[model samples]
Target: MSIRHGLLALLDQGPHYGYQLRTEFEERTGATWPLNVGQVYTTLGRLERDGLVAPAGEDGEGHVFYAITDAGRAELRDWFGTPVRRDSPPRDELAIKLAMAVTVPGVDVREVVQAQRRHSMRALQDYTRLKARALAADLSAAGPDPDGPDPDGPDRDLAWLLVLDQLIFQTEAEVRWLDHCETRLARHRPAPAAPQAPATAPQASAPAAPQAPARRRGSGSARR
Candidate 1:
């Protein structure tokens, strides 16, 4: 998510100082993505320059509060209308590590794969636990919707639950892909060569005793 847009969204809620915006953003995201105070101020500066936000005023502490402009609200609406682009996928560091491991000598690729699978499985478990917590929070915060007879209004835990769900899905996919890779590797392995039977020894031929009989027959006849 763009920090600029995030800050604008927070400003859309209410006027907020830089520090307040940073804290609120982290609270909303459950700190899965922490924002630096410096980044918050920098993004605010850019937003002010773009005319998307403006200085509302300063507090007694000399901290300037910012509020979203009409332009910012329009941008936020447009952002909500458009789906995030997925033309290019972000690089997966684990995938790159495994790719290099298989090509490089002395690297145990299967060991690497197993290690990653273990890590991903642990992450999946963590996300699953967090999801349960989010669901419980949602139930606890449930109230009648103001606009309708629906038993549940918007849950405050929705943002964290969405982030947790994404983590859970991604980790599960990694584990399954690792298992598939192991199966493919095993299938592609070369088969062992079959052992040959011992060779048989050739039998020796009989001596040519018949050849001498021809010469002896001639001599014997002459003698006769």
Candidate 2:
């Protein structure tokens, strides 16, 4: 995520303090990516150094505010116009884990896929519920003109809805990918074990049988 561009976009609206920027960012994006106060100030400092923003004096409560420079407005406009490239996607930890699981010994790839699927499905459900709730609230606030457009123009609610919709779609895609991994794993077979040699038993010896003939010869001689 480009925190720089995000801050610039926020600054384009009006002068805001660090805490205010952070709050608005979370609110506008439906808190999908929460920013700490430190991160907010760090980004603001960078923006000032780059001449994208300037200190807009202190408020009555002694809170320092920052406003977007002309350069910042131009940058924001360009960002809004440009398409986010996907030729080189960021490294996904889950994808890396699944890939490693399938290749490494003693790792159950199916289980990994199933576990991720369950987690992703739950996230999808949550996003769906949030989207529904947001819509319902907006409808209620619309005061019986639920089907009509809002007269408030571009507002925080609209911004949040857009962000929530994106999250829902992204999570749905992840669940589908996990299901694909499981299907592939189902057809996989492990290597067979090696064969072993059979064992043999020892044979017994036969008894001698010629002793009776000698005894009979001796008896015949005595009789003669």
Candidate 3:
């Protein structure tokens, strides 16, 4: 999602001010990633600097309008013509957590995994509920016969539903992975060992009784 390319594509459609571009971009993207006015201006500035776009004129409110140039059109065409690679960098948070968990001692990894499973399940439930509600509302507003087609229907709703479906699938997959993690952790945990008592040293054998004291003591007592 290059901001420069996106702004150029919008400008290619027609000349527009920064604010107008921002509004249109959000609308077209279903407001999934809200664009700031500053970002729009920044992207426009870059596009102007690159000679992909140029200032058209000022509007009634003194906002400068920008129009795509010949070079911009060529760039847009190249962008559209190019195929995006499906091999994107992976961002697996659970993998990182599991890697670190094994390194930490006394970390009760099972508990950590179970907690994540609970959280993921809750998220899946919430997303499912939201999707159901959205679909119901879309049907209700669809008019008389539920199956009747909408003559003036907008495809934006369908696009939103598709996005929601993707999110739901991702969340469900995460929940299933969490369950597997918990099961594996429980299955692999080692059982606790029983404690042992300390060993006592054997008592030394008693030495032979000392010989009786010499009779000299008795003789000295008699002389005294």
Per-model TM-score, in order, reads: 0.75, 0.79, 0.62
Candidate with best TM-score: 2
Q: How far off is residue 130 in model 1, in Å?
A: 1.4
Worst 10 residues of 2 by lDDT: 211-220
Off by over 4 Å in 3: 28-30, 70-83, 86-90, 140-153, 187-224
1 against 2, candidate with superior TM-score:
2
Q: Report RMSD for candidate 2.
A: 7.5
How large is the C-alpha RMSD of every model relative to the true structure? 11.1, 7.5, 9.6
In candidate 1, the residue pairs with backbone N, CA or C atoms under 3 Å apart (3 or more residues apart, or in different chains) clash, namely none
For model 3, the run of ten residues with the poorest summed lDDT: 151-160
Expressed as tens digits, the lDDT of each residue in 56-128 for candidate 3 is 9997889999999999999999998998766894668887898799789988787777788788788778778
Determine the backbone clash count of candidate 3. Answer: 0
Instruction: List the candidates ranked by TM-score, beginning with the highest.
Output: 2, 1, 3
Expressed as tens digits, the lDDT of each residue in 94-176 for candidate 1 is: 88997888789988777788888888888888889889988986885675555664332343377778888888887888889
**Candidate 2 wrong stretches, greater than 4 Å:** 144-154, 190-224
For model 1 the local lDDT of residue 27 reads 82
Q: Which residue pairs show backbone clashes in model 2?
A: none
